[model samples]
Each structure stands twice: as C-alpha cells, then as structure tokens.
Target: MNPTATALRAGVRRGVIELRQSLTNGADLWNHAFWPVLMLVVTYFLRDVSFGRTGFTVGALALPGILGMNAAMAMVTMSQLLTADREDGTLLRAKATPNGMLGYLVGKIVHVSGGLVVDLAIFLVPGLFLVPGLVTGSPDAWLTLAWVLALGMVAALPVGAVLGSVFSSARAQGLLMLPILGMIAISGIFYPVTALPGWVQWVAQVFPVYWLGLGMRSALLPDAAAAVEIGESWRHLETVGVLTAWAVLGLVLAPIVLRRMARRESGSSVARRREKSLQRAGM
Candidate 1:
C-alpha cells in the first residue's frame, strides 16, 4: 500500500485505541456532552431575545458557532494529548520505525475527527427538532453550514497541532487558549458580529474564527443582510481571503514545525519532562 494509505490506516487504528481509552477514562463523555448541553440550555432560555425580529434562535445561529467551538475543542484537546505523548516518549519511540511520523499524524487526525463527529451529533439532534429558526430557513443554508464546519476543522486542526508541538509545558495550554478564546468571543459565536465595534470587526477579519462565523452567518442569516444599503462586503470578503491564506500557510507550516519538534525530542529528554510533570503533580 502507498505511504499515505498505510499512514491513514495506522492513524485510524490509533484513533480507535485512544478513543476507547478516553471512553473508559470519562474524557470522551465530558467532551462530547458537557459544552453542547450547556449551550443548549442557554440557548433555550435566551430564545425570547430578538436579533431584529428574526429572533435569537440558538438552533439557527448557535449550532454553527458550536460546530466551530467543536473544532476548537478538538484541536486543543488533541494537540494537548499529542504534547503529552511527546513528553511521555511515545513519539520519540515511534520515530525510529518506518513511516512512524506519517502514522502518528494520521492517528492525531483520526482522534480529533472522532471527537468532532461526537460534537456534531450533539449539535444536530437539537438543531433538527428544537431550533425553530432553522426550521424556517432554506435547505441550502444547512448545506452551506456543513461545508463551513468541515473547512473550519481543516483551518483549526493544523494551527492547534503546531501550537501543541511548540508549547512544551502544560501551563502554556492556558496561555495558548486565552487568545483563541478571545477570538471566539469576537467571532460572534454567541451574538451578532455587526453589534461589535468597527475595530473589533476589523481585528476579527484576520483569523479563521471570523471566516467560519461569516460563512456560517451567510448560511443562517437572511438575505437582507447581504443586500444591505452599505456594510460587510469588505468584511466578509476579507474573512474568506484570510481563512484561505491561513489554510495554505498551515499546510506548509505544520509539517515543518512537527519535524523540528520531533528532532528535538529524544527518549531521555521526554523521560525527563515526564518526570518533571509527575514531580510537579506530586505523583
């Protein structure tokens, strides 16, 4: 079999193993259920609020945002796990074997994709039955949302992987997540982007979060927004352009970053880090 195919197979196998372990350990349930459930409750309560009489329908707007949230969570959790594997010397041990790196990456993708599947399932169940606004929208809107969610995953996963490889300490997870969380806040995940300040809107244009939100809004929001007297054209176009640019950049950059991180990770170094982590935990 070709290297890509072989690597993908290995990735699938590893992902299954990791997922099973997560299930046993309770991580899978928490990640799959926790946030979505919270969001659902919040959305249900806030259903009365109106965005210009269109209504603040969580099912219509929030689902896409939650999907984006899913991407973020998958990326962060998988990256952190990869970081732990690196610190524990699993990656270092794999490096000596043929097609190891390929398999390793494959596994990471598989694991994250699995998590995304769970997240989507949670979001969709409510979206189909409970979201009143979604019921009234075009079928095309849902299709657009599907594409945006997939592409958003592509955009976020690489960046997260790169961050995991670069950030050696667990403490850095908090540091790394802060900026991303800030972006999510501004991306109109819970509210309207148009309500945000101009400078904040401009800042959002630079990242994948904004594009994901824009693409999602295009799917969910009414056509009147698009036909507005004046506004959002440059903002929307910039989002598409920036996200596409980042996707390309991530593809080129991820491998390079991973390779460098791999080169720096030796068994002894990993063991030392693991020991340090354990020591810090008083374990």
Candidate 2:
C-alpha cells in the first residue's frame, strides 16, 4: 500500500475506535447532531411551505441542497472536534509519536467520513419514504447524488482543516458558528438563487456551498435551469472550478498555519495560562 494510504488507514483505525467510544458515551454526537439535522429539516420544511401548488414537489429540489449542507456542517463539526483535541493536549500527545500527528489527523478524517456517510443515508432514506416524489427515480439521479455527495465531502475537508488550525482556542469555535450559519442561510440551499437579493446572490457565488447546491440541482432537476446562478452557462463547471480552487488553496495553506501553531506550543506556557484561568474562575 502507498505510504500515505497506509498512514491514513492506521490513523483511521485509531479514530474509528475513538468514534465508537464517543458514540456509545453520548458525547459530542448528541450535541452536534442537532444543528445539522435541524438545518436540513428546516430547509426541507421551508421548501414545501407553500400550500397552493399541487404536485409542486419541492422535495426533489431540496435533497441535493440538504446533502450539500449536511456535508458542510459535518466538516465544520469535525474541525471543531479537532480544535477541541488540540486545546486539551491530545494533539500534542499524538505529535510525540512517530507519524502520530499524521495518524491523528487521519483518524479525524476517518471519523468525520463516517459521519458524512451516516448523514447521507439519513438524508436519502427519509427523502425516499417521506418524499417519494422527491427521490430521484432514475439511476442517473442516483449517480448524480453519489457524485455530489463525495465531491461535497472532498470540498469541505481542506476548509475544515484550515478552520481547525486557525481556531485553536475553544472560545473561537463559538465565533465560527455565525459565519457558517449565515453562509447557509444565504447560499440558496433552501431557496432559488434568483429569489435572493442581488448582493446575497453575489456573495453566495464566492463559496462552495452555493456551488454544491447548484451542482446538485443540475443533477436532480436538469430543467430547473433558472434556479442555478450561472444557469448552465458552463453547466456545473463554475461550481466545480470554484470548489476545487478553494480545496487546493486550503490544502496548501492549512499545513503552513498548523506548523506555525505547532511551533508556538510550550507546555509550560499552557500550564501557566491554565492556572491563571483557574484562579480567575475560583477553581
């Protein structure tokens, strides 16, 4: 096996064990699962809110968007978990071992990957039973769904890693919430881009979520051309291009930032800061 794959697999095995523990312990999953499920469910409800149209079928339009949104949320959650590990010194411990840092990050990818798989299943299974008309009836639609979902995860990973490195502080995690939530709100994940304000539409063009939603729409409803911001001018090329660019940029930048952060590490300084905080808290 290739070295990277071998390293990744070893890391993933460790991560899988940790994930199982967390799942059984009802730790982060309980708290984090809510936001993702809520975001998708609320978007689904909004899509079908109108009562007057018979066979209006908003579900089909919503599936691809929800899947994309869920992938983004899962990635964000994974990044935050990594940050938590860093703050608590788990990452530091990993770094002391050979390729331990690589393994640890690989483990995180494996763990989050599992979550994304679960998220896809949850999104699709419900769409099939709860919104039968919305589920893509063709093999082509299934292919599209699979492609978009995998692409979404690939697109989210680099950003997640960068965010995890940048926001090493636990408190910084809270600040990230607004921007992510806001991005989803304006990205037309729940509505058509044409219906959003011009400024919001322009803003959405800069991010992967919009591209993801557009890509999904392309596969799910080929005739709903007006719904996409670029509207088949390049088919899904714009989305693919923008997302791939972000992924590449993030891949280059994340490790540099992480290395910088690692260099600043001092166990003594961390201990001093912890003690100061404890004193301030009367702990």
Best by TM-score: 1
- Model 1 per-residue lDDT tens digits across residues 89-208: 788877876778878887788778777777677866776565565532578878877777777777777877888888887766778788878988887667766678879877876777
Give the 10-residue window scoring lowest on summed lDDT in candidate 1: 225-234
* lDDT, candidates in the order shown: 0.71, 0.69
Clashes of each: 1, 0
Q: TM-score for all predictions?
A: 0.87, 0.85
Clashing pairs in 1: 11-107
Candidate number of the best lDDT: 1
* Native-to-model Cα distance after best TM-score fit, residue 90 in candidate 1, in Å: 1.8
Model 2, 91-172: lDDT tens digits are 7777666667678777887788776776567565655555434536678877866776677777788678778877756667
